[model samples]
Target: MPLLPALAVVLPLLLAAQTIEEQEWHLDALDVYSAQDQSRGDGVIVAVIDSGVDATHPDLAGRVLPGTGFGSSKGTDGTTDVDGHGTGMAGIIAANSRNGGALGIAPGAKILPIASADEKEQFALDVVAESIRWASDHGAKVINMSLGFSSSMTPSLVKAVNYAIEKDIVLVAATGNEGKEVSAPANIAGVIAVAGTNREGKPWKSSNVGTDTVLAAPAVSIVTTAPESVYSSGYAEMDGTSAASAIVSGVAALVRAKHPQMPAKDVVNALIKTAQDLADPGRDEATGFGMVNPMGALTAQFPPVARNPLLPEPKPSTTQPTPTLAAQQPVQPVVEMKDRLPFVAGVAGGTALMTGLLIALPAIRSRRREPVVSARDTPPTPW
Candidate 1:
């Protein structure tokens, strides 16, 4: 077992319940969790790439690991919680705090945190790319990314996700709070795009949409944690897909807990196909596969894996020799997300834009050089 990392820096808000019970409580009980529990997602490794989890929170204390941080205030012990967003996200995914047990989708799972808060365009791209590659190569079965860039795809991150897929890593991403443009990584193919839905089971007005979106989860009125300093308004009421994305990631973890053998993508597919229809007769822009149905996805029988009986005719080799694993050196863990944190946000348009731009300068320069390896190196499975 090694380490593999992935992340999302976009921190929107999520609606939370003060004491747990609310009119929309059952929304969090969607099949994504129960299915994983029924199937056993508790045994898997769910890497949370975000601001940094408050590992001391009663609900998530022991369940989270100080894997690494990608932001400036690097912690020797891994508790990099500053903005309060990461703690909230971690609560949704693996929080087991008693009373505050807040109870994650998969209670038995372990979380690996990769902390990074910088959000400039180039910095964001490089941090995300490095995080994904780190998690995949190290041994993360599932990588949860709750954020992404607003513009088109960055080659590095895109390649990193592609490499993760090759390694059979499952990637989950937030649909974005702005909702208008399809955010990078989420919009990219082979990666699972998770959108947000309110208690009424309606997609959040701000949640992004796309045909490629895999499923929508409870985004509004979702309960979680916040940094002590973040509550200038007092009691936190998170209200965005950021929370929903955590819920989805938790379910993905529980799925691995139940069925350790199933790869990340298949688990994602199960949830996608099993999702309950929320909008029209079938799939639509708002609710891709509908609210994630843990029960349905867990119990739903995946189509039997059938091998293509006849092999496709082989194409003639162009000219050069195909490199083998023996010829290539073993992939080394790339630590691109250390002190140089990618700008998480504010670079697009904000007073702090210059600061973000300055932070992103190094990452941009790194991109100018040859890619360390493929976007993400396909590390061997660690389970």
Candidate 2:
């Protein structure tokens, strides 16, 4: 099946009359307005690698930069969207408040649209790899991959991803909508894998979950731009991890714009550290670190890291500094209780109840562990 079909498109009228604030619930959920006060992603180029993006759309008119198309999409530039998926993803990242239409998380960010697949979705893995390389070379600071494959990563794609990372490009991708293992590209190391969350901040039922997931964002009923042919209003409600990934990509753009001096590694660190924890607390497979908090990501204070945490640690060198007496001693791992306090408290309470049960066992022998029900135990009849 075409992965593009994974997203469900609602009626155009649903967004035709809705106000900007009313239509884009994700903005309020992530406190995008407050976050924008700090940075609107200006000077950041976010490349949307998917189907084509409709540049003519009111919300994305001038925000879309000239982009290229591959495979069957080569007939036109990456400006015409045959499938509305790319348009939706682009709007989520950089749509402006034109015609009172949908608003994006980083309205000032420019979208570098790369059409990897046409309407048939016949694009190969090599095409995706080529697109990544193109985006990296073309001044794209952040690349939004709202598409994925069920197959394993190709060698060429892996090299392309590494190339982008080496160039300090922030890669973000959706964790897929199959409710299975995270799809390739997103599952690849060093990529910010985004999962889906509903308006209530709970995990979206259809969102794929895995240890690779990096963050969750609003995916259900997300209002974004679409091709005019797809929706007369030039907008529609979308549902999938595709939208979630785009939302996180927008936040990454904001971070890049706000801290132009910050390296890609630090940008990734800031986003992961500032997210709001959800579900099982502290980096669970369902929600990763948690929902991507724009305000926190934009304004929160945190230490800078030496490297991207998503990538594997480098091997230790043979030559090492002479160990001091304190260094020779084993360093105790510091444990933060706030994350697991609830589970720890629950376990303690359960232990106390078990002890009480053991103490009362001798006195309660008269009662059966399981309630007995016999044919004679029928309810009493009315007079």
Best model number under lDDT = 2
Off by over 4 Å in 2: 1-17, 317-383
lDDT of 1 by residue, 1-383 (tens): 22322222221112122333222264345744345447545567788777677676656657776677564534434475655556667767776535422556766777887775554323366667778887787678888877665555656666787677768777888766665654666766666678887767888887778775668888765655444454322113456666667777777776666667876656777877777888777777777877877777666778643211111223346795644212222222333433332222111112111221323433211001011111122112211
lDDT of each: 0.59, 0.74
lDDT of 2 at 257: 98
Top of the candidates by TM-score: 2
The true-versus-predicted C-alpha distance at residue 231 of model 2, in Å, is: 1.3
Q: Write the per-residue lDDT of candidate 2 for residues 57-135, one digit (tens) a residue.
A: 8778689998998877765669887656688888889988665666888999999999986445434566788899999
Candidate 2 least-lDDT 10 residues: 340-349
Q: After superposition, how far is residue 218 of candidate 1 from its true place, in Å?
A: 1.1
Q: What is the lDDT of residue 122 in candidate 1?
A: 35
